[model samples]
Target: MQLPLPPSPMALPLSGRFPAPFLPPSMRKAGLLHPIASASLSPTIKDETIDWVEATSNFFEKDTRPIMLFDGVCNLCNGGVRFVRANDRNRRIRLEALQSDAGKKLLRRSGRAPDDISSVVLVEKDRSYIKSEAVLRIMEYLELPFPQLALFLQFVPLFVRNIVYDNIADNRYTLFGRSESCEI
Candidate 1:
């Protein structure tokens, strides 16, 4: 039996596949051509701000660069970390397994559940981004196509982006398999 598909940004043309800004104004306004919401027409960085006040108040005790805190035991999370490590030539993207002391501190500071392996966290001095926003923002550290792709995905709303992230996260262990530790 064919299972019903989940409602996704893919349903909104010029969104899931190609970058929306690439579409001509004529195509975008056509509505028939681009099924995206009008609000998405304008640039909006839909990053969720996590409160790190309590966590970083004194424990961290210093201005830290952007840190990518991930599920140390999740294979999928490890693979992503490796990919970023390789592509992030400058090493601007720092990684910390949520299973680590530093990672736990950052998560608690950001008011995130340390056990929530389903969501990845990107912590910066000013703010933190979780879930899909973390993934896309991390892409900016890479050269070429990755940042470009992130630019396109940024236009899509967080709710729309989360659908895909949540689906994969829900079945990550089953699909990519899991390990006891994703430490690098």
Candidate 2:
């Protein structure tokens, strides 16, 4: 649901080893896209469109921290969050249950349906990725050998990756077993 808006004036430069560009124009225009931005921004939808920068810039000003939003009640998702928390050695990642207020707000800001909880979302500076894209983004940030694997997977077509991701998501609850509470 991300808007196809024109580029902004203050777009930031992309960085890091992850091939993904920093603040792609789409993300930059949509707002909520800064490497060190805040995730507390709340966007208002109006006239069948969002105010974009006005609604997002206030919340993400100077903060580009990535927000990881996952399905709260899904055991598989919870485990994934736990794994991220434990292995993100520098504590570079921030997490939220998709059912939480913050997470919903982020989803909306990213122009995604807030109710769609099947996908894991990675909110990076100026861009948001879901499903297989989100997975690859997370993997790209991981330490060493894993990043290598992510790089290898990047060569596959996106549709193929999404199909694989969809299969796993479709059966994760049955395979992993859901818990009464999301403990991640």
Best by TM-score: 2
Q: Write the per-residue lDDT of candidate 2 for residues 131-164, one digit (tens) a residue.
A: 8878888877766776788889989988898898
**Cα lDDT, all candidates:** 0.67, 0.68
lDDT of 1 by residue, 1-184 (tens): 3333324422222121223323455654775433343344333222323344553555335635578988888888889988998898888777888878788767655544455556888877656677788889899878778999999999998888899899998999899887865667
Give candidate 2's error at residue 78 in angstroms.
0.9
Model 1 bad stretches (over 4 Å): 1-63
Weakest ten-residue segment in model 2 by summed lDDT: 9-18
**TM, every model:** 0.66, 0.70
Off by over 4 Å in 2: 1-59
